[model samples]
Target chain A: MNHLASQLVLVPVILPLLGAGLCLAFGRSARAQRIISIVTLSIVVVAAGALLWRADQFGPQAVNVGGWPAELGISLVADRLSALLLVVSTVVTLSVLLYSFGQGIVEFGRDTPLSVFHPTFLVLSAGVSAAFLSADLFNLFVGFEILLAASYVLITLGGTEARVRAGTIYVIVSLISSVLFLISIAAVYAATGTVNLAALPERIAALPEPLQLVLQLMLLLTFSIKAAVFPLSAWLPDSYPTAPAPVTAVFAGLLTKVGIYAIIRVQTTVFPDQPLRTLLLCAAILTMVVGILGAVAQSDIKRLLSFTLVSHIGYMLFGIALATEAGYAGAIFYVVHHITVQTALFLVAGLIEYRTGTTQLDRLGGLARAAPVLAVLFFVPAMNLAGIPPFSGFLGKLALIQAGTESGDWLAYSGVGAGLAVSLLTLYAVAKAWNRAFWQPRDEHVDDDVPSTGALHPGQNTVTEDKVLRLPRGMALPTLALVAFSVALTVAAGPLIGVSQRAADELVERTPYIDAVLGDVP
Target chain B: MSVDLALIIAIGVLVACGTTLVLERSLTRILVGFVLLGNGVNLFFIVASGPPGAAPIVGASDERMADPLPQAMALTAIVITLGVTAFGLALAYRTWQLEGHDDVQDDVEDALVIRRAERDDTSASFDEVDESLPEEEGADLPAVDDEVTRENDEDHESPDDGDPR
Candidate 1:
């Protein structure tokens, strides 16, 4: 039993999913369900941290399930990069659960919605871990499906008219992306004999350049949709706002980054010599421009934040497009920092909605006056998101711009400018939302009751608790924990940058990955 | 392409059906369209993968081993599509029950006041509505346009009483 210590790596991916099933089975008691979920997630979080430390020691270990050879069966590989995403995802999800404890599950599933929320959330945490750890293409696909299936339930849980409609769009877009991804996998398989990502570069190299480009392009299409890049991003802004606040925060924090992660993985590991560099730069520019344009027009806080989510993806992609060492490091740093800052800001938005009964600027007011503690919570993340200095977002944006400028390519240079412009635009949009919801005076009488506009929607009930939802200690502490970590990321940007560089260098170099899989065995 | 022609044509028909359904006024039809679209894409995948070069079975003869990977990828994709389709159908049904119609145009009736926009014929109506509506108090501040969009407001106050409220 002690000999199988390495196999424990799979537990973080398995336990919470099993926990989800247990919650569903024991659905009668909310207290029991909540306890089961929290305890299970806490254990998973510990496992993830241990796994990160283990990966650090082992330097990208691969574990084959059922003791099959790596080439023949699924392999759960944990490198430093995967460990980073795994740790970040588990921490964010567990925190969201704590946040929802007091806020209450107000989003989907009417008959025992909390019962559904816990189980599905646990399953989602498991899915994210699996996707992060997977070294086999087939296992990656399974992980992607797990995450997608869980998300569908969360997205439509409330069954509100707004939620349902938004969910419809989300499902359709996701389905198409899934199909495209499948087609690409099929094409890659027909061209190459195997599906192990470990063996890809050698196999992909033997193939013609055109075929390589095709496979790379297919992957780009699939991941771009997930990342919500440019033309592929229409679904996110509308869909995200309609879900419950905590669910929205998790989705914003983690889901799109999975796409960015895939792009990084595929580009660096699978097809290093491909012609995607220019195309990526073009997409980055358009994604920033179009996403910011949408944000500029929004008066609703959630909607504006969703657009900013799309725009920031452009910054991440810009780092990828550069295809240089510094560039990849910058992209990885951006991913971690963005995940923390984005989720905290969203939590702040959720807090405002709880207090004011609406997130629209016109209806919401005096929140700075109404909930000063919550106001500061919202303020820190908002500035961070806008890439203000001394915060993690600023450090990431600076690294990315520096990488782009070092390349000195005209299109890449303009992409840097466009990224900065988009940041300014994001700042303006978020600031406008802040001024309206927090700074401006609100309609006190209307807010006293249900804040009914009765024009644009069938009211989806937001849990308006009378106890003054000022972060409710447990929730606020976790949110602030993530926010403080974001500050730490900025403070220790040098070491963080070093870690990303190590991961990026190994990936672009590709020799270690191939040798690890194909065996320098015999 | 020596792929199954029938399957290819069926995929095409489904694509057309889906495109049309998604364009319709009712959300139910649109969900049906999405289902058709997803199935169509799956069919297209089958065509692209060279009709499953062999069984998904792994066995003795190396040359005859059908590539199990694409089939595996397809299987996962199909499962995801099924979950999404089910969720979408559930949402449409729930919306229909709540609002009494699945018309996406009227998806939000009372809540999302900020995003509602009236695309009324021309500026003739825009001018009339803007002129007739009183300015919000605090005119000196920046106009962030949190006003309820006129289209949704008009839909709520439909002229005909027979329409579903």
Candidate 2:
């Protein structure tokens, strides 16, 4: 059973890649591509669930590729955290793939060219899985590059003028971050003999204090850009809103969290003794305050959601900064909650865009009356995003706040304060969007001017001419499923929190993971 | 391990030039910068591999063999950079085809924010000012909106019409 669990670590990373190749082979038939992707991801979802159960039942599971020694060859490790996140992320990706199929089928018909989207999407899933499971820094870099390369193609899939422009910024920024990551990896390798995560702790501990700090900061800089933390997050809102809704939704759901996941792994395991708490707390506070402020200013629902996505990253960073078991638990829980809720919200926004011609607040109205189900869809996630009670978002925020207050530090107290304020501001922003886009009467002037809406450059006006008044059942079902899944997070918060606590304990102790990777070495 | 001054100097020079070019507006220049930056980082990996030695083949030489790991990683980095270069060139060419230039444009939303800031209008919402303000004061707001709309229209359309280059 133990050996079987260990071998299962490779499934999440390998299956999707194999699926991608098959998808490319069957590129002519969109239906074939769809079936292959759905079957591939559904199988992954089940495997991830089994992996999580096994990880919880056993300890961390590790597999060395090519049967090489742990330190010499690449290793993939799945402990409680990676397995749990893998389950949630795979579920989210599967749903988003379904949602994209809905969008593609409805807009472009079932026979639309199946060449790039499915294969690239599968490659992205593979990349994300590899990043989560990788036991070494270099493999993590490769994982990032794979996912990013896939994202670059996905973002510019249509090659629209706006998409091209947005994709340029996205690609350039990602390239710079990748370069920085490589430089840091080089520095780490130069300082320590091995890039293996299991071996690095001892060597990194022996480095001079200042040198350790430099290495830590270099990595933090690279990850901060990827995570879309403040001062480095300007590119997110500018680029994300221009892509197709499903692409934006998946990117919002998975990509930045992968960066945060890396930060958590590195901070807790690699540089455990580094006293960079204050710097991280400051970044958290700023990311929260500034991100929400930006969200409040946006008139476009997608961009507004993008800003909130940035804002909520602050919450996870806050949990990590607290550096307590409760804090880690809170951060992990928040990551799960945010991934579901944010993706659901974006999918809802896509549904809204599909029904109406635009997502602009000024131009949108009467949605509640016109489409009650859409209203319900949008309302549930919006409230969840704002941390309303009886939702996972609220539970996750409560956990973070509880962790912060337990620390009893002034910095944490301020973080708690900023967190509460940001929550309120998030509510304000989404509520404003709701009131304008749904509750109010459709402005007659804007309704009459729908033909000219495409000429209006700033707004994401995808279907300006032929407005699809009815929501596609394919799209709505997956979105509803995601929203329901997020609600389930609240209902299952007890077991989820317990799992995260155990994961946090393992992270704090660090031996379980190190042993899982290197214990059998001769 | 003996350090190579020339290799260090080359890494520094390449990275410096890459950073400078990356800050430029032109997409082609940025793509070039990205390639240079990637090469410089790859060179750093070579340095990290330690002093040069015979190829890392088993029993190839009696002397210390070069570390094979960093070379493998450097090769990976080179492959990734090559993929990125191809994508970046394609993107730049697409931009040229569309806009008649390869320069990145300012984000329209950001430019609007700057315009609002310059006018001392720190209102949270852009389109809501008319409803909040009195008739005469509100009258001036639509003109600002029109000005922005015109600017955006010209921004998208002017390049094709004029073909300045």
Candidate 3:
């Protein structure tokens, strides 16, 4: 049983890969693909949960593929940190997958040529899992590549002019980042003859200061681009808003967080004593300020949510920059919180888009009266994102702020201030969206976007457009499930925070991870 | 480990050319730039593999055998780059098919959105000081609504006709 538990880490990555292949084999059978994808993802969620339990109980576990030595062969590790992320991310992906299935039914009926969506999406899940579990730099890069390739397909699903345009920019930016990451890997291997992350700290520490700085800065720059940190983040808002709603939802929620996860992994593992601490802190401040400011100025809900996504990345970076156990704990907890909240918000945005034929704030009005359920859905996540008390977002932010103040550094202190401002601005932005889109009185002019009253579904109370807005059970159920999952995170914060703090401690110590992999190598 | 000056210089030249080409507005140029960049990085990876020597196979003389790991890594990088370039060019071809231009066009609304954000920010700052601004300063407000309505109009015209391909 212990042996099996140790090997559970591979299931999360492998299950998805197998599911993707099987989904592809199902070919054009959207029903079959949906069943295969959902079942596979559900099993993956279970697998990830088991791994999280095992890691939390058994300490960090390592498995070298094909019985090869750890340093020589690829390794998959299930530490507390990776395990926690794997669980949350898979859960989110499952919800989004279900949402997309709902979308498929609505858009193309039973047989959508976009059958390609299922296989590509499963592959993306595999990639994300691979990234989280990978214990080496090269493997991590491979993980990123796999997910990115899948994302390229997902983002350009319909190949519309706008999607193609956005996809072009996204692909170019991703390719550039990939190249930079390759260069960084080569340099690291050149400096220290191995890319095994566990073996890196000693070798990297032995390198001269200037050389170490170069490698660190290079990796940081690559990840900063991937993570959309401040100045490097301009490409995000433009690119993400154009994808189909479910695609946009998942991309907005999980993709950037993967970059954030990488940052935490590299910073905690390879460069535990951060050399660019001050720089990271400054970037956090600017990212928060700039992202929220952009969010506030946006009139489109999708674009507004994108900016908020960028802004909230600052909080995670805050915990990372502090480089303390408390900070890491806060960061981990915040990551789990943000993933759920962000995914739920985007799902709600997708709902809004489906119902209204647009997500523009001006065209949508009195939705609170019309679709009370959606209003509650949007209101929950929006307020949660705004850090309203009793919500997980608030708890997460409070943890980060506590850690920031405990750091006693001026940079961290300033980051706390910026974080507070970002929270307030996020609230104002969401409130403005809510007021305009949901609370404002319906206007006949704005009703132009809807179909003529004749097309209204029977019993749809369309006072102005004379049309009823039907919320699909398929879509709404998954979204409501996610919203409940987030609320559960808040309800279970005490235990979750404990788990996060323990995970943070293990990450901070680093000894358990190294020992688990290298086995007390001198 | 003696440095390979020639390889280093070639890599530098490749990177320079790639950078310049990538900066151009033409999608084909950008594609070429990306290809060059990939090649340059691959070459750098080879350089990072260190001085050339005997094959890394067992039973070969172990005297300064060439490191095979970086070579393996570079090969993977090359495969990935090939995949990316193929996808990018396909996109470029598709763009040409649709819009009849290989040149990337700036999103028409991009500038307008940015300008509005800036205008709103300035007006917001003014309001912070004045605390009582007339409706004239609300000009940016309506402009944003106009953009939304225009976007809504476009969205309504072909509600289901995305990606005719």
- Each candidate's lDDT (Cα)? 0.76, 0.88, 0.85
Model 2 spans with C-alpha error above 4 angstroms: A1-4, A108-113, A444-455, A458-466, B122-165
Docking class of 3: incorrect
Candidate 3 interface RMSD to the true structure: 6.7
Question: Which residues of candidate 1, in runs, are more than 4 Å off?
Answer: A1-4, A105-112, A443-471, A520-522, B1-80, B106-165
Residue range A1-522, candidate 3, lDDT tens digits: 767766788887888889889878878676788888989999999999988988899888788888888788877888999999999999999999898877777764643366678888988999999999888999999999998998998888778777788888888889889889998998898889899999999999999999998999899899888889998998898889878888888888788888999999998999988888899999988999999988876767888899999999989988998999999999899999999999899999989878876676755788998899999999999999999989999999999999999998788889899999899999999998898888876572432222322233333323335243688888999999999999999999999999999999999899988877776211
Judged by TM-score relative to the true structure, which candidate is superior, 1 or 3? 3
DockQ of each: 0.17, 0.26, 0.22
Classify candidate 1 by CAPRI docking class.
incorrect
DockQ preference between candidates 1 and 3, better one: 3
Selected candidate, larger TM-score, 1 vs 2: 2
Model 1: per-residue Cα lDDT over A1-522, one tens digit each: 644557667877888978988899999888888898889989888877877777666666567777777788777777767877777788888888888775773422343367778889898888888888777766777788788888888888767656777877776677667666765666666677677897877899898888788888888899899999989997898788878888899999999999898888878788786477888899999998988877776657787789899999999999999999888888998998888888887887877776656776656666787788878888888899999998888988999999999999899899889988988987888777777667766654322122233233445434344335544575667677777777877888887777777877767787665555555221
Fraction of reference contacts reproduced per prediction?
0.31, 0.49, 0.40
Ranking by TM-score: 2, 3, 1
lDDT of 1: 0.76
Off by over 4 Å in 3: A108-112, A444-468, A520-522, B60-64, B117-165
